[model samples]
Target: MEAGYLFLVGPFAYTKLGKRANADTMDRITIFCFVASYTLALMLELLHSWRGLIAARIGALLSGLAGLVAHTLFLYSKQPPLIWQFSWLLFVAWVLVVAYLTGAIHYRRLTWGIFVLPLVLALVGLAVLFGQPPERGLWTTYETHTLWGPVHATLLLLASVGVCVGFLASIMYLFQAHRLRTKATPGTGLRMLSLEKLEEMNRRAIWAAFPLLSAGMIAGVVLLSRSEVVSWTDPRVLSTVVLWLLFAVVLFLRIASFLRARQVAMLTIVAFLLLLCSLVLSHNQPTGG
Candidate 1:
């Protein structure tokens, strides 16, 4: 009886220890892990573009998928993960990676992966610049739990994703347009969507972004009115307003036919630049007292 009990307990202890070890390994995963994976994927994409190898395309897809899995696990490992600049940027990058993977798989003929992967790498690099969270932490549990807080954050995140989509589409439009104007060959197997489709993508992304951004701003205002910790004169608020105005201007120009597609693409790129600035300069202040 004693021997049997010892055997049972030994197995249980070993299993528990194994789980703990796995958890620790996951927690130990650094941003560089996924960054390197994504970089590898991007390089594979470039290789495919240059050589038109099916093997390179397959390798790129696998690498991207691996990076995404690592990114998800790393995010899950965060202790009581809170929404803030560093984590938010990571989340955005993760979303874009998912989008890239989906598009790459679905539209195998298009060279969107080349354009999108660079942006993903840039976002990850920017997130690294924000570094780790402080011991004291920037946001309290109570702040994030507030009624309007999550709503506002979710909308803004979606809006950011939309802006990124528009930015990419505009870039594709410009490239396709330039290629057409110069009558350049589509660079080996590097096929792109026509200018019309690219323009439509840009327009639809902005159309979706405008309303989401507006709703997010409204929710933010409501949160501000309810919270003593937030103020109207915050730079973040002002920058957000400026960002919205730029979007509005772009929409008006696109709708009014005042600016051609090429000009609209240029303005969309400008908005994208501002969006990057806003993301970089954004502070993770406490949402409520």
Candidate 2:
């Protein structure tokens, strides 16, 4: 009778362990699936850059959409809504990709991925490195789930998208500049816009982003007020102030010959890089506090 009880208990324990292991593996798979999906989508986008194939473009679109769906499910499985810091990052990427996909379908801007995917990858990769809540130590204040949380994240991400535009436009400007100096053809192969258009895009992007970024900062203050864990002088807060000030300089200089066009592009690049740095730095603070 004792032997029978031992055998039954032993099997039950083994089954429980097996289930736990399976659950852990599934969690990892979700991350892998979504990340790989984005990667595949990016590769497709690059491939389209060299050879504009309709099938390839369609494949890229599907891959991006699929990755976004997987990302949603991945977050859902971990928590009903977003509980992880990375989710906020991925959520923004998802929104941006959705917007891109819609624009591609509507205006037929198939080449936009060359500009969009780099920003998407940057956000997603940095988010991955931002670390996750411990397997069991997921604790956050009311602000995380409340209106403040989404409001703060959304406004900031929209602001970041504005920055992303500047970044993409800067890249296009440099390329176009090189082509003009070299007296190269704006080939059908190089599917890019004119320098004037790109600069206009950059100017408008920074203008649109400045106010949103400022609002995001204000929202951050409001959100932080509710949370006792965060301090007034967190590196992220200071970094944001600096970033905002730099934009102010760029805006001011735009009115005069304070800086040349290339100088402004360089500054825009620097500003976006600073934004990226702050996203990573924010993780060093005490999480789950």
Candidate 3:
């Protein structure tokens, strides 16, 4: 009887220990792991541009891929859902990394990583500063897991991504335009999309973002009306509404052909700045759901 009892207990103990070890290993993963990875990738991209080395290019791509894997794993390891500011910022960074990788692979001659990776690092840095859990802990599923909550958050997230893309495109357009105006050559191995292409990209991003922002704001208002915590008059809410209105005006001007490419790019950059303000000022609030 003693041997039989020992055998059953031993297996259970072993299994429990194994599970705990896995959890402990996962817990050891900090944001720095991926931050370092992305930083290395960005440095490698810079090196590739200067030296024109295929190895450096491949290394940068591999580093980005590794970072992406680590980022996904880190996100999966989190106990709470991805509804809060901390997780949301990380998610946004993840999406930007995905965009960078796609562009790097598809437009291998273009230095997409150099432009996009810095923003990824910045987002992660911001996450570190402003995205810590509150004293009461993150908002629980009771508030964040409702039907409208995810919809609202997701729309906003996508819209934010669009804004980021447009910002990058605008910057690239300005850089390329300046180079052309100066009759300067691109960096040794660096290539850029044409001015026209960059302009088109910026326009498309705004077009996509406007509808998403509109839908997100609508969903947000509905979600807020039901919540007792955050009010419509909250700074976060007001700022986001302002952002949407700015996007609307920009989109209309672009469609109406009233604004030149450079003018539109400037407006897009302004929109991105407003978005940064909204994100920085409001991330610490209890508006996660």
Candidate with the greatest lDDT versus the true structure: 3
Q: Can you write out model 2's per-residue Cα lDDT over 92-143, one digit (the tens) per residue?
A: 6766777667755764543677677777777778777876644432534454
Summarize candidate 1's per-residue lDDT along 1-289 as a digit string, tens digits. 2232222122223333234446878887888889989999999999988888889999999999999989977876553223356666677788899999999998897797899999999987877787765443344533364556656766777788888998999999988887888888765446898899999988888899899999988988887777666567766777788888999988887788998988888988887887777766565442111
How far is 70's C-alpha from truth in model 2 (Å)? Answer: 2.6
TM-score of 1: 0.85
Please tell me which predicted candidate would have the highest TM-score against the true structure. 3
Can you tell me which runs of candidate 1 are displaced by over 4 Å?
A: 1-21, 79-82, 135-145, 186-189, 284-289
Deviation in angstroms for 12 in model 3? Answer: 28
- Candidate 2 has its poorest 10 consecutive residues by lDDT at 2-11
Candidate 2 segments exceeding 4 Å error: 1-29, 75-84, 106-110, 134-150, 222-229, 256-258, 284-289
Clashes of each: 0, 0, 0
lDDT per prediction?
0.76, 0.68, 0.78
Candidate with more favorable, higher TM-score: 1 or 2? 1
Q: Which residue segments of model 3 deviate by more than 4 Å? A: 1-21, 134-145, 186-189, 286-289
Tell me the deviation in Å of residue 174 in model 1.
0.8
